[model samples]
Structures are given as C-alpha cells and as structure tokens.
Target: MTTENLLVELFVEELPPKALKKLGESFASQLFEGLKSRGLVGADETVTSYASPRRLAVHVCNVFATAPDQEIKKKLMPVSIALGADGKPTEAFKKSAAKAGCADLIEKWPNAEDGPDQLYVANDGKADAIFLRSMAKGTSLLVGLEGALEDAMAKLPIPKVMTYQLEDGWTTVNFVRPVHGLVALHGADVVPISVLGLEAGRMTQGHRFEARVDPVALTNADCYALQMADEGAVIANFAERRAEIVRQLQAATAPLGLKPVEDDALLDEVTALVERPNVLVGKFEEAFLEVPQECLILTMKANQKYFPLLDAAGKLTNQFLIVSNISPDDASAVIGGNERVVRPRLADAKFFFDQDRKKTLESRVSGLAKVVYHNKLGTQGERSNKVELIAVGIAAMLGNEKLESAVGTAAKLAKADLLTDMVGEFPELQGTMGRYYAQHDGLSDDIAFAIEDHYKPRFAGDELPRNDVGVCVALADKLETLVGLFGIGEKPTGDKDPFALRRHALGVIRMLIERDLPLNLDALLFVAAGIRGFSEDVAGQVETFVFERLSGMLREQGYSAQEVDAVVSLKPQRLGEIPKRLAAVRAFADLPEAPALAAANKRVGNILKKAEGEMGTDVAPDRLVEAAEKALFASVNEIAPQADAAFESGDYTASLQALAALKAPVDAFFDSVMVNTDDPALKANRLALLNQLHRTMNRVADLSRLAA
Candidate 1:
C-alpha cells in the first residue's frame, strides 16, 4: 500500500448561507467514512473540511492509492446433496464446482487442499456444506475515489434542491445550486473522476472581483487553501474566514471603546456571505436612536447583515460595522451605500412605533376576535379570556388581591400587540411591543413589565418572569395553550410540535418550580380545563405530558434514573418540592437499612395486591395474633407519628430517616408470617396492617421504585 494526501472540491453557485456549515461537515465526514469503509484510508487519519459561499471541499491525509486485498469464502451446496453414500463427489458437485470457476478442483480432487483455490467441508449450522476459498484483488484509487464521490454527493444535506441544465442543455441535474467544476487530486496528480456532469481538474475560479488570477491552478493536494488565498484572493475555509471576520470586527470597534453585538448566528451568516472580509465603519443619524434599540438592531442585522455596535452600557450606538467583500483604496462609496440602505429600514420601524402608540393596548383588545388562534379552540380573544380566568384563579391561590388585579389586566392585554403594526411587521416582537405600548399608555411599570414578561423563559435556559404578577400571568398563559391544544387532541407527536406544546409545558414546569409558587399542579390544570369545558381525561393527559418533561429535565440535571423514578412516580402536586424529595431519596438510599426496607416494601405491596377485595389500613389490636405481625404493628405505631410530624414540618429528610427504624420489623414480619392464612380474620388483619405500612412508607416517595 502507498499513501498520499487527497483533496476533493465541488464548485457551485452561491450556497445557502444558513446551511453552509452543516453541508460542509456532512460532505467531509461522509466522504471520509466511505473511503475508510472501502479500506482505502486508515481509521485514524485526519480530515479537514472547507466551506464557503461557492464551494464545499475536504482534505484527507494518508489515504492509500490501493486498498489491501481480502480473502473471500463461497458456500456451495450442502454435504448431503453434493456427496454420495461413500463420501465421493456426485454429479451435482461437479456442476456446482464448474459453475463456481473451480473446475480444476474437481479434477484435482484429493490434491486440491494446498492450492490457491481450495475446497473444504464445514457445518453452516443447518447441515454440512462445501466452501470454496479465493483471493479478491485490491481496488485502485481511480475506482475507489469515484464511488466515494458519488456517495458523498448523494448524502449532502442540501436544504432545497435546484434543477439546472448543463452546457449540453438536454440533461438536467439537481443540486443545492448549479455545479460549475469538480476538483479531485492525489498528491500532484489528478484522479480523473466526473460528478454532476463535471470532470475532475486542478483549475477553480477565485474571488469574483479581486482575484490575482482568472482561474487559480492548484499545484498539489496539500496547498489548496494557501494557493487559493494567495492567488485567488479567497479564504477557502469557513472557520478561518469566520475567525478573520471576528478579528476585523474587534479591530474596527476597539478604537472607540465600543463592541459589536455578539450573535454567533449573525456572525456565521456574514462569514458565509463574504470571501475576503474588510471591516469598515458606517453610521446613521442619531435621531434614529429614538426608536427602540431592539427594532433598529434587528433590522440592521436581519436585513442588511451588518454588525451593530454597542456602548459599554450595552446601549446601541449610531455607528455600525460593515463586512465588505471587496477592498478598495477609497472605501467611502461602500460605507455610504450601507448607511443609505439602513436609514429607510430604521425609519419604517420608527414609523410603525409612532403609529402603534396612537391607540391604547386596551383599544386593540377587540381586534383579537378577528385572529383565529385555532379553528377548534376559537379566536385569540376567547383564548385571552380563558387566560384571564386562569390567572385570577392562580392569584387567588396566592391570596393577594393586588396581584390578582394586576394579573387579570395583564392577561387581557398580553395578546393585544398581535394586532399592532410593530408586531405585525416583526412577529418576533409580539410581547416586546406590548411592553413599550403599555408604558406609553400611562400604565404602571409593574403592569408594563408583566405584559412583556409573560412570554419569559421561552426556550431552554432563558430567564423567568421577574415579578409575582408576571409569574401568575406567565403560568396562566402557558397552561391555557397546553390545555386548549390538548383538548382538541392536537398533542405533539414524535418531534413534530407544530404548536410548540412541549415548550409551553416546560415553561409551566419552570415557573412552578423556580418561583416556588404555592399552587397545586392538578388544581391549576383543573382551573384551565374548566374554563375551556374540557373533559377530565384531557387534564390527565396534559398532566402526564408535563411530568414527562419534568422527568427528562431532572435526569439531565445529573440525578440517577432510579432516584427520579422514585419521586416522580408519586406525582407530587407541588413541583417545587421535587428537588427536596429527590435529595431526601438520595439521603435515604445512603442509609444502611435502605435496600432491605425497599425490598420489604416491594414484597408487602405484592402480597397486599393479591388479597381479596379492598384492603383497609384499620388494623385491630386483638386480631394481631402472630408475634412478627404484632411487633411490626407496634413499630409502625411508634414511627408513624414522628414521620408524620417531620413531613408536616417540610423536613422530608428527617421523615424518610424515621422510616429506617421499621426495616428490621418489616423484614422479620415478612420472613415469619404469611400474608394469606387459612383463618379469614387473621388474613384480613394482616392485610390491613400491611396496607398501613405501605401507606406510611410512601409518604415521601415510592420506596419500591428504588428496589433493584
């Protein structure tokens, strides 16, 4: 085997900026694996992926020019069908061997065991079979590379395919964009392969406006990136290009004691849009700052792909940074061009803001009737009414009149911004514009913030609502969405949550737990369900769905599966208490008596489940006949009150620890006493006693779930 570095490139029209990173990664990895599977590359070799606006390429080191030969085995007919009664070859054996290209072995017979093509008898697990062994030739680079290229191109994660004809115009090919060239090289030699109607070559075009050469010619496999940069004026690697953009941004902003807005996604998009980046400063009139900084920043970044600068206080500045693809001695025209384009966009935002405040959020409340939230669930107005009811109920549970009033008002006006011009233009600013408009309407800061913060913690690790009223409204809003959608049987299936029901459920869970709200989960669901006239079964399904999300969250936080199952199995109403319960379970598991008690608890549960009719926890004193049963009853009587006291005081750890004293009695009772006795009275008493034990042991968590 001989080894050398290899390079593969596909030149096409400008690729989708959002998908360039993934497309590059997929192409490189799939191509590498394809060659490795064919034994043309070592498993430990390194691969470098390069992606830009117009190309996706990969470089692999130490790839073999020829794969190693392999030994192959072929199974012929079974022994019974191939051999005669005296263990001699029959006519069937002769025909099979000749067809297998081993006819020489048929004539050689007994002497064929030592040749390149040999015959042997082996059992294939059903019956005896004859096998022929041969050597397979190695694959050359030209053949292996062609197969690898096809596999790689077939598996590219193209977001959307475009169909275009080649120069020959009769045949059409589909790709992310029109293919122009393909480059495949091993060392200094072209491997000579064709893909997507283009033949492999060393020639590839460079920057459209600033390349030193018309078509840069690569000299070797290892110099593709450097040569492209030096002669073609293009930074061929995506990560390297992104790093250069970051460096220029920092250099451009450091002199004024300002920083560019930090958004990885925006930075990646800009990096994909440019080949060679030149950072320049551009500015708009300071009057545009009268609009909300979020609106201006969004317009500039989203529409123009410019990096907005911010002062040390995190306030937006009038100056912004532009990443130009071409560098000229006089860059005034480019800077002016960008500034001219952004002013109209900012003016539109300011216009929407000025016009939306002309009417109060309360006035727009009636407009929600025209917007259908869901066909089965009525309009947004109806949804807001449901949320208002749920919020008041939650506030009443908290026993605060002021909070209840604020929650009701905020819930009514939360969705009013859906009809506002600012939000209509930028749907991402729904709750945001509500806050601004509420402030302009002479509302208090608490109410205004609540209107904005109701959609807090929208995604994972996001901030929760700030004030108590915000908490109530946020909970109410999420619960309404969950209950309403679930009532219509539009639950999330698999990964397709078109309505983001899972996010709503998780948001509800976070508020209940993080705020340590003193509301019962079932009661809250019931309140929302009642408002929508939903059945009890819908409430139950929503509850299960919420708890499933909570279970996954707890596991992700590093709790063991057994510990989480033990606590979640009980369906504790106050989700705020879950952390304390899990901590107590972990502490109880560390005790020396934990395993025995858990096992004994499991045994008692199984025994009581098999008893006739319903078992009561009323154990009569006179019916406790056996010594083991009597001792167990006595121990339960002593420990029950202490455990109940600790549990009532919110000391779950002490409560679970109190049950450790019952371990010995529980074990001895199970060992010496049989739960099912011939005497009806004794069996009934034992069943009642075990029921009492099971109930007492499970107050904190289901201990049986901890059993192996």
Candidate 2:
C-alpha cells in the first residue's frame, strides 16, 4: 500500500462571514472522519482546515491511496434448510446459492475438500446457518474521495442555499455560493473528483485583486498553503488570519496610547471578510461624538465591520481601525474611502438620537399601548403596568417609600424606549437609550440608571442592576415574563426556547442568589402572578422551573449531585440562604460521625413515613422506658436549642455542627430499640423521639439525601 498527503479546496464566491469559521471546521472534520471510517486514513493522521472569504479547503496527512481489502461473511440460510437428512443439497439450497451467484461453488462443497473455505456452518444467534466467506476489493482513492466529498457537502451547516446555473446554462446546482473551481490532489497527482458541477484541478484564484499571479497553481498537498501565500497574496488559514488581524490591530493602536474595543464576534466577522488583512486608522468628524458612544461604536462595528478604538479612560475615540484586504503604498485613498463611508452612518445615528430626546420617556409611556407584546398577554402598556406593580411591591418589601417611588417610575419608563426612533432603529440599544433619555428629562441618576438597568444580567454572567431600585425593577420584569409566559403554556421544550424563557428564569435566579436579597421565592412569584390573576398552581410550576435551573447552576459551580439534592430538596423559600446551607452541609459531611448519622437520619425518616398516625415532634420523657431511647431523648433535648439558636442567628455551619453530638445516642437507640414496639404507648413515644431527632438533624438540609 502507498500513502500520500491529500488536499482539497473549493473555490467559490464570498461565503457568509459569520458562518465561515464553522463552515471551514465542519468541512475539514467531516472529510477527515469520512476517510478514516473508510480506512483510507489512520487515527493519528493530522488534518488542517483553510477558510477565506472565497474558498474552503482542507489538507490531510498520511492518507492511503486505497483502503485495505477486508474479509466478509454472508449468511445464507439455516443448516436444516440447506441440506437434507442424508447431507445432500436440497432444492431450497440450490435456489439460495443461485441467488447469491455461488451455485457453481456450492455444487462441489460436499465432496471437494479444496472448497471447504467457501462455505461453512455457524450459529447465527437462533440456529446454525450456512455462511459464504469472500474477500472484498479495496476502495481506490478516486472512488473513496468522491464519496467523501459528497458526504461532506451534504452535511455542511449552510445558513442559506443559492440556486445557480452552471456554465452550460442548462444544468443548475444548489450550494452556499456559486462554485467556480475545485482542487483535489493526492500528493502531486489530481485525485479526479467533481462536486457542485465543478471538476477537480490545481488552479485556483486568490485575493480577487492583490494576487501576484492570475491563477495560483498548487504543486503538492504539503506546499498548498505556502504557494497560496507567496503567489496569491492570501492567508489561507482562518485562525492564522484572525491572529494576524489581532496583531495588526494592537500594533496600529499601541502608538496612539489606545486600544481597540475587544469584541471577539466583531473580530471573527472582520477576519472572515478579508483574506490579506492590513490594519489602518480612519477618523470621523468630532461633531459625531455628541451622540452616545454606544451608538457610534455599534454602527461602526455592526454595520461597517470596523474596530472602534477606545481611549485610556474607556471613552470612544474619534479614530477607528480598518482591516483592508489590500496593502497599498500611500494608503490615503483606502483610509479616506472608509472615513467617507462611515460619516453618513454616524450622522444617521446622531439624527435619531436628537429626535428621540425631543419627547420625554414619560410622554412616550402611552405609545407602548399600540405595540403588541404577546397575543395572549395584551400589549406592552399592560405588561409595563404589571411590572410596575411587582416592582413597587418588592420595593415596599425591601423598605422605604422613596425606593418604591423610584422603582415604580423606572418600571413604567422601561418599555417607553421601544417607541423611540433610536431604539427602533437599533433594538440592541433598548435599555441603553432609555438611560440617556431619562437623564435628558432631568430625572435623578437613580431613576435614569434603573430604567436602563432593568434589563441587567440579560444573559449568563452579565452584571446585575447597579442600584437598589434597579434590582427591584430587574427582578420584577424577569418574573413577570416568566410567570406570564408559563401561564400561557409557552414553556420551553428542549432547545426550542423561542421566547428565551430559560434565560429569563436564569436571570431571576442570579439576581436572587447573587444579591442575597431577603425576599422569599414563593411570595415573589405570587406577586408576579397577581398581575395576570393566574392561579396558585401556575406559580408553583414556575417555582419548580426556577429551582430546576438553580439546581443545574449549582452543579455547574462544582457541587456534587448529592450535596445539591440535600439542600434543594427542601425548596427553601429564601434562595439567598442556599450558599450558607450548602456550606453547612459540606462541613457536616466531613465529620467523623457523618456517615452513621446520615444513615440513622434516613432510617428515622422511613419509620416516620410508615407510621399510621401523625407523629408529633413532642417526645414524652416519662414514656422513654429503654435506656438507649432515654439517652437519645436527652441528647435531642440538649442539641435542639443550640441548633435552633444558631439557625436563628444565620450561623448555619454552627447549626449543623451542633447535631454531631447526637450521633452516638441515635446510633445506639436504633441498634437496641425497635421503633414499632408491641406496646402502643412505647411505640408512640419512640416515634415521637425519632421525629424530633429527624427535625433537629435536617434544619439546614435534608440529611437523608446524603445517606448514600
């Protein structure tokens, strides 16, 4: 067998910039996997992916020219059906052998000793069957590569497909972009494959305009990247190009004592838009700075794919960096072209900003009525009212009338930005624009920031609200969306979260746990449910959904399943207390008596559950006849007050530590005394004692969950 490195490239029109990275990775991996599965490549072979604005390619090392031949077994039929009692071929056997194209081989099987290798009897699970053994021919590189190419193309994650006619003008093909050429080479020889109506060749275009040669010709798989760079003026590797852009951006900005805005998404998109990156600085008029820096920076990054520079104080500068595909001498034209292009975009943003400030947020509050929030949940105006009510109630619970007034005003104006021209133009600036407009209306910073911060912690790991009023409004807004949506049976199923309900639920969880707010979870859900007049059961369902999200979050934070189960099984109302409780549970588990105590606790719970009547925690001391039971009762009496006091003082660790003293007595009582005694009075007293012991041990967390 002979092995050689292989290379494949698809030359096409520009690919979708946002999807280029994934497209390249998927194409390379899928092609490599396809070859490996067919035994044409070894497990340790290396693969490199190349993606540019106009090409997708891959290079695989140590690929075999043909897969090795394999031995195959084909089951014929049961032995009973193949041969008669005297061991002669039956009619059924002849028909099956004829259909298998082995009738001539089967005729000599009984007497010819050399034909033994062709047919044999083997158990095919249920019965002994006659099997035909044969050798399969190896797959040549040409056929295998064709199948692999077809498989890779079929599995591409194309965002959209385009239908275009080939050069013949009669045949059409569907692809992400119109394909002009394909290069498939095994070593120096073309592997002869066709895809998307294009034939394999060594010639490929490069850089559109900056290439030193008209058509770059690759020599071998190993030299493809080097030749492309030297002759085509293009960097073929996606990651390499991105790193070069990053390096150039740093070099361009370092001398100015500033840095480009660090956004990986913007960097990737810009990297995908060009093949040979040349970083250059461009500037806009100082008058555009009057508009909010967010609007200016967003327009530059989102619309023009430019990297906006920021000063040392984190303020947007007048100059931004451009990643041009061509590096020309005296590059003033490229710089001037970009600057001229961005001036109108900035002017449009400034116009929208100026127009939005004319009407106050309070004045626009009524305009939200015309905007439909959800078909089932009335309009944005109605949703705003619900959020305001929940916010005011939360503020009152936290304390102070001034805070309640601020939260109510913030909630009312939060959705007012939806009606603004600036926000309507850029929906990402919804909360951001509200803050500016609120400040423009001569409102206090508290109200202004709250109106903006109400949407804080919008995604995972995002910052929470900055002020107390913002906290209340944020929680109220998220809870209203959660409960209202769940009430309408729009719950997320699997990955189909159209409304991002899971994100909303997680936001609520983060605020509650991170802020350590004293509000109860159930009570807050009830307040959020009140606006829609939803039933209590709906609120309970929302609570369960929130706890599920919290449980997953805790596990991700490195807590064990048992530890999380112990704490969350109680459904503690105050989510803020969970961290302290988990810490206490962890500390209790480290004690020497923890294992025995957890087991005893589990036993006690099972006994209490099985008892006929309701078992009260009140233990009658006189009825404690056994010495072990009496000692256990005394231990519980002594430990209960200490644990209860520590729990009240918020020292959960001390509360759990106090229960370690009862382990010995509890173990001895369970060892000697039967909880279900013959005498009814004795049994009742024992059950009550065990009930008290269970309650004292599980205050911080359910100890029974840790029994395993």
Candidate 3:
C-alpha cells in the first residue's frame, strides 16, 4: 500500500484570540482520529498543528490515499417475517436486499434452517431471517477528507458564530468567522474538498502587511510550514510563535533591567492575535505609579495586550513591552501610539483609586443593606452579621479571644469594597481595594490583612488566609456559603455548581487539614447551620460532602484508593488526623501479618453487623468455653490498652502495629468458635469478644477497607 503525508488548512477572518489555541488543537486531533478510525492512518503517524490569527491547519504523516476494504455482515429482519408461509423470500426481504445494494443476491439467499449464515431468534420464538455478508469498498482520500473535515468543524469549541454570504450572495454560512479559503493536499496532489462555501486550493493568504507575496503557494504537504515562513512572513505553529515571543520579550527586557509580568493565558492570547510579532518597548508617565500597581498591571494586560515590566524588587515600573504585528524602519509611531493610548487607561485607574479613598471602608457598612446576597439568604449586610457571629465563635474555639474584635471588624469590612469605585471598575480587585482603603483609614495592619485575606483559597491550590484573624473570617465565609446553600437545597449535581460549593468545601478542608486547626469540623458545621437557623441534619450532609472532596483530593495527591478509603471511611471528626491515619495504614500494610489481620477485621465487622441483640465490647473471661476463644479474649485485653495508649499519644503507626499480634488468635477464634450457638449467654459473650477485636483493630483506620 502506498502512503503520503496529508495537509489541511482553513483560512478565515481573524479568530477569537482566546479560543484559537484550543480550536487548532481540536481540529488537528479530531481530523487525525477520524482518519485513523477509518484505517486511513496508522497509530504511529505524527500530527503537527498550526494556528494563527487568520488560519488553522494540520499536517499528518503516513496517510493512505484510500482506506482498506472491509468485510461487513448485517443482520436483517426476522426469519419468520422475511420468509412467507411457503418458505420463500417475501417483498420485505427484497426491499432490504435492494437497500443494501445486493438486489441480485436475493434469490440466492438460503433458508434460515439450512444456510451458511447464522440466524438470530426473537424472544417471541421467531428467527431473524436475513444476513447480508459482503465486501465494502474503501473511500478515496478526497471523499473521506470531506466527511472528516465536516465532522471536525462541527465539533470545534466555537464560543460564537458569525453568518456571512459567499460570493454568490444568495448562500450564507455560519462559522467562527468568515472562512475565505481551504487547502487539502495528499502528497503533491490536491485532494479537493470544500468548506464554508470555499473550495479547496493550494494557495492561502499570509500576514496582511509583512508577507513577501499576497498568496503563498504551498508546493507540497511537507513544505507547508517552511513556505509559510519564507513567503508568507508568518510563524504558523502556535507553540513556536509563543516561544518566539518569550525569547523576544526576554531579549528586549534584559537591557532595561526589568521583567515582563508572567501570565501564560496572556501570552497565548497575544500569540493567537498576531501572525508576525515584533516586540517594542513603551513607557507611561511616572505619576501614574501613585495608583496601585495591581491596577496598572491589570489594566495593561486586560485592556491592552501589553506586558507590564517589574523592577528588581518585583515592583511595577512605568515601562512595558508591546507585541506589534507590523515592523517599520523608524518604529517611533508604533511605540508612541501605544504610550499615548495607555496614558488614559492608567489615568482612569488613578482617578478611581483617588475617588475610592475619599470614604473609609468603615462607612460602607450601611451601604450593604441594599445589596442582596441571595434572595433566600437576605442582603450582604445580613450575611456579614452572620459571618461576624461565626468568626467570633471560631476565634474562641482556637483559644484566642483577642481575635474576636479583629475578626468581627474584618468580616464587617470584607464586603465593603464591593461598593468602591476601584472595585466597581475592576471587580477582581474587591478584597485588594478593601485592604488599601483600610490602611488609608488608619486601621491596624492585622485588621486590614484579615479583610483582604478573608477570600483566600478561592480556588484549588490557592494559599489560605494568612493569620488567625483571617482564618476565622475565611472559615466563617466558606462555612456560611456551604450551610446556607445546602440549607436551601441548591447542592451541586453533575457539572453544574453555579455557586462553587465544591470549591468552598475544598477550601474548608484545606484550611483544617493543612493548618492543623484544633477546631472540630462537625462542631463548626453545626454552628454555621445554627447561624443560618438551618436544620441540624445539614451538618451530616455537609460533613459527608467535605469528606468526599477530601478523599478525591488525597487520591489526586498520589494516595492509593484503598489507603484513602481506609482512613476516610471512618469519618474521623478531626480531619487533621487523616494524613496521620493514612501514613499509619500504609506502614501497617507493609507488615507480614497485615493481610490476615485485615481479613479477620472484615470478618469481625460482618459478624457484628449480622449479630442480634446488643454486642458490647466487654468480654467476660469466665464465659469463654473454647481455648481459642479464651486465647483471643486474653490477647484483646493485652493489646487493646497498648493500642489505645499509642493512639492517644499520636503514635498512629505504633498503635496499628500493636494489633499485628492478634492474627494468630483471631484466625484461630474464627476457625473454632461458633458465634451463633443456641446458648444465649455464650452467643452474646462471643459477640462481645468479636466486638472488642473489631474496635481494637480499627482505631487507626477502618482496616476492613483494606480487605481484598
């Protein structure tokens, strides 16, 4: 079979900058997968994707001109239905054979009782009569490419669509943008296909101004990228273009003794927006620096796709770098235009900052009354009040009554920034603006930091609140969200978490487990529910949700499912003890007696679950009949205390190891003892003995989870 590399491209009006990278990747991968599924390409073949502002393309290696022929067998109608009373083919069988393009073979069809093909019977005692067995011809590259391209286009992650008319003016097409050209090549030959009313060709437009020629002609599939660069003046590959920008930014900023603010998302957007990138240095007036540097950096990155520079101490400077699509001999006009344009943006930031400081954050307390938090949950003012109460209670629990005043003050001012001019203009600066305004109000540093840090750990892997006061406020805020939302029955289902309750739950878990706070999770949840006047049952639901999130996070952190299950299934009140319990379980699993012990523990759990009446942990040695039962009771008496002592001392590994000595007695007891004997006292005593063994084995973790 002969093979050749294939090339595909779609040239269009500039794409959405943020979605270009994903679109290109999806297009290439989907096309490759589609071809491979049809046996047109092999698994080992390589695929290279190219994306620019105006085009998306892919080059796939080792593509076949046609897919291999396949043998197909399709089961037709039931034998009773296809055959008439005279046992001959009926009109229905004729139609089916014609539909399958095998009309001439209908007369040759054998009866179900004596045919080479197998017959399938229906549940009604009727047999499916016809089986069409034939060879299917392969599709040529041109035809297969058309279907593949259409499928890939339909599956693109387009955020929005635009409708434009073709040259005929009567026909319109919807796409991410108006597509002007499509190129499909197999080796040196054009595998002609059409998309968005444009026919496939070998020529595509390049950079608007810098291209040496208007339409760069691709000679073959292998030379597309090289020709695109040499004649089109465009770096077609997205990753390559991004890397080039990074290199140019480094070379440009090194001489200025500054560094560009690092944001991968910003870099990718810029790469997608320009085909021929030229980095230029620009600067604004130093007076604009009086505004917060965060405002300046954010404005430069968000409003204009400019990279702000930072000094040696990571302080924002007036200088920034711009990636331009054009390169001129003087370059002064381009640099001056960017500087002039950025001056007004920076001036607006300074104006908002100045206007916001006119009123202290303390004065904004009453302003929250009109701002509704949730229709069911009341206003932000009411929410703040609830948070204040929760924070004070948490502070007391941490043995720090001094934090009550600070936490209350911080919680009161946390949402105040939402009403400020700076925050209104840039909603991402809510907590940060509060911190700045609080300092201007002559507030203590502790209170100011606490207000800003109250929303910490907003996402996964984010830092927690900085201090005890911040911890109190953050915990209160998150707990309020969980309790209030769960109370209203707005829990997340599937992928829809409009309120980010899962994130809040993970934040609470991270704070408790990472900070090793002595606060009990259940107590905090119950108190939070109480603040909202919610049912006490919400605590159990909230606890289960938090533990589930913890289990997933721990598994992601490289713990095995069994280890996590062993610890999390116990539902220990002190979440901080989970990691210790997991460590202990892992250590015990390495012991020589672990498998037998885990099996015994599981058996004991099952026996206890099925046992009738009250099964107490108290075992009377006098009631033990068999020597094995006596030996097991005696071993439990000796080992239970040692395990309990080690557990209380926080030596979880030592505690679990102490139970390792029970394997022999446990196996022997289960083998010899009849726990369900007719004698009432003896049965109860045996159940009690097993109960003691179960309790002692599971102190560190639910060892039954480790059972295979």
Best by TM-score: 1
lDDT of 2 by residue, 1-708 (tens): 889999999998999999999999999999999898787999988999999999999999989899997777899899999999999888999899889877887778674225324777789999998888776777888889889988998899999989999998899888899989999999999988887778898999878889998798898888988988999999999999999999999999999999999999999999899999999999999999999999999999989999999999999989999999999988999999999999999999999999998899999999889989999999999999999999999999998899998898999999999999888889999989999999999989999899889998888889999999899999999999999999999999988999888888888888888999999999999988887789888899999999999999999999999999999999998999999999999999999988888998898889898999888888887898889999988888889999999999999999999988998898789789988989998899888888888888888999999997
Tens digits of lDDT, candidate 3, 587-689: 9999999999998889889988988777788888889899999999889999999999999998999999999999999989888889999999999999988
> What's the lDDT for all of these models?
0.92, 0.91, 0.90
Ranking by lDDT: 1, 2, 3
In candidate 3, which residue pairs get closer than 3 Å at backbone N, Cα or C atoms, i.e. clash? Answer: 78-128, 78-129, 79-127, 79-128, 79-129
Task: Report the lDDT tens digits of candidate 1 across residue range 514-631.
Answer: 8888889999999899998998788899999999999999999999999999999999999999999999999999999999999888888888777879889999999887899999
TM-score of each: 0.95, 0.94, 0.94
Q: After TM-score superposition, what is the CA distance of residue 579 in candidate 2 from its true location, in Å?
A: 1.1
Q: Which residue pairs overlap in candidate 1's backbone?
A: none
**Ten contiguous residues with the weakest lDDT in model 2:** 109-118
Q: Per model, state how many residue pairs clash.
A: 0, 0, 5
Q: What is the lDDT of candidate 2?
A: 0.91
